[model samples]
Target chain A: MDDDGRDRPPVPTGRSERARTAALEAALALAVELPYPQVTMEAIAARAGVGKATLYRRWRHRGALLVDAVAHRNARAAVGDGRIPDTGDLQADLSAVLRAVVDELAVPAWDALLRALCVEALVDTAVGAQVLEEVFAPQITLFARRFAAARATGHIDGSVGDVEAFELFVAPLFHRWQLRTGALDHAYADAVVRRGCRALSP
Target chain B: MDDDGRDRPPVPTGRSERARTAALEAALALAVELPYPQVTMEAIAARAGVGKATLYRRWRHRGALLVDAVAHRNARAAVGDGRIPDTGDLQADLSAVLRAVVDELAVPAWDALLRALCVEALVDTAVGAQVLEEVFAPQITLFARRFAAARATGHIDGSVGDVEAFELFVAPLFHRWQLRTGALDHAYADAVVRRGCRALSP
Candidate 1:
């Protein structure tokens, strides 16, 4: 869970939050521009214009830095990103939500952080669980609520449960993202929503 | 692409193939039994019952070893496992194919190799490309052919391409697998197939 701690450094405090954010933003930007292996503490410090000691005191190495960068971004995104637009039309609402996600994902910062986080999750169960709870669990819960509302309104049918409906709504986009199989666009989002409505409706 | 090769050794040859195979199998077995960091070269050699040099002469470190192990296993599984039973019923045939995949994925060796390869792919694009072509591409191709047949029989619509059909068929299982959000069993397989059939049918 600790990932050997040779990499994890001290926890960021209120005093260090701004400094840490700056450093992580620099780290994520650099990571997007270069390969993960090449994004080093010294380079991040240089880019952030923070003292090398500032980074070293908080992060022992690259892994901890990247993990926390993604974690931090995810936490911030979750604050306002969770609100799905409600049009009462389940298809439009779901497509709108998915397209919003594509927009969020298209950001260079989020893109790099997500790619790095997915890699870390694959290597470390602690990170994986962290993402599941902090990122996916909340989204899934919201989607479930939406689906239930839709079902009550005669949008989605009773054939599919909330869990299955949520999976149907979101899993395809995630699958494409992880596998690098295709593009995530408005057209793709609409297609998924259309297919999902057909499958989930009676 | 090379992943810094500080740990990469020479390529294994004809004489070393046997040695390499044994060591990789042992490595994969131990990987399944333990964490990635703990699955060391010394431990693999000990478990494999080969000289340490036999391992070092071929693989420089753990990543290289695990990647090769997964690549080898994927190559072998692709030969026979890609054949989906054609029952002439679209829903039944897809369920059978997905169930077969669930069975293959359930194996300890395959599970471990897959987890290892996914992590390696995150760190190395060369390994990622190799997996795409060697592992995913073949299966996707076969699924495309099957979907085409289903289409010819008026099962699936011309609205969705073979690629979209394949994605709809398989992405849910992968999403569940990667996220550990649900069980991958006969019921799960059937649910996914049922949803897919409804979504894609003419």
Candidate 2:
């Protein structure tokens, strides 16, 4: 029906898309089911029902594959509709973002996957950089932009440093989660954003 | 030789304190030399010149042994004067603590041990809980107490939440160090305390 299209549904380019999705899903599932040290490319390929060569052709190593999977998962779940909502209330916006993070982190699969990635990153320097640059850094940038917007609107004190404010607001959540020291909840999220905003007040 | 002397050169106790020390040192050394997953108890014991049974007797598993070794190293390095140095300044106290932490964390052995422990903790729930309770929770408590003192002294607003404030000030340092994002330097430390104190001000 279309130019350069053969009959029989154009062989479904969706098949490759489905395969990639399935591979990522398999990687995440295996990460949850097995320890990070135990996860292997061969195992993921088998789990995804793709050949080993196919997976290797797509990703050079397990770290690369895993990082892509995490990035994909995060992009799918991130909030804000690509705009940091400015409700004339900085506190509300911060609270909303922080709460969304809390919800995303609450997913057991996410927790398991992050924990595995963190462990792998610690052991592998290249993977660590990739995870930070590709995954964590972007999230921080988004929050920093929102804080910058708030500053511009005069809702936040201009004296407050952007990077410091960004770290002050988000680091607590990750610290609590990574160290397993406390609960990462809506209550905690509300407190973080509230305290952070108040600190930034003129 | 003085009081409880039932000793003919103390028959080694079949658990030489020297052996334990050596094993810990070896574990830390090997962790840096080899990947964490490859640093087996057998390897540690061999490196320490002790029997595998000796290591097993003290630690239930490799994870437990590694956790203890890392915790012990942190404790030795963390010895301080136990004074929160109040120069009538909240920022001064925070600076002193942060400086001490910087000094301790600068040691290569400490960094390696911590990395190994952190990696193991991700997959091992018991080890993770132990590290949190024995290491992180205590450090957080110390900061919380100092914040509470600052609140009482009227230097900081009493209404500012202590726990959240502590995390806001300290988590970034750990995040940067553990995640290898940026240098944990004095300037950054000073900025964190200054901005964090302002943020918590009522």
Predicted model with the maximum DockQ: 2
lDDT of 2 at B156: 78
- Superposed model 2: Cα runs more than 4 Å off: A1-22, A29-39, A47-49, A159-162, B1-22, B25-39, B47-49, B78-81, B159-162
**Which stretches in model 1 have alpha-carbon errors above 4 Å?**
A1-82, B1-75, B78-82
Q: After superposition, how far is residue B92 of candidate 1 from its true place, in Å?
A: 2.1
lDDT of 2 by residue, B61-84 (tens): 998887656655554454322445
Estimate the overall C-alpha local distance difference test score of candidate 2: 0.74
Q: Residue-wise lDDT of candidate 2 within A46-103, one digit each (tens)?
A: 9999999989887779988898777666655546226567787888888888888899
All candidates: DockQ: 0.46, 0.54
TM-score of chain A of each: 0.70, 0.79
Estimate, for each residue in A21-40, the C-alpha lDDT of model 1 and write its tens digit. Answer: 78978987887787666788
User: What C-alpha lDDT values do all the predictions have?
Assistant: 0.73, 0.74
Pairs of colliding residues, candidate 1: none
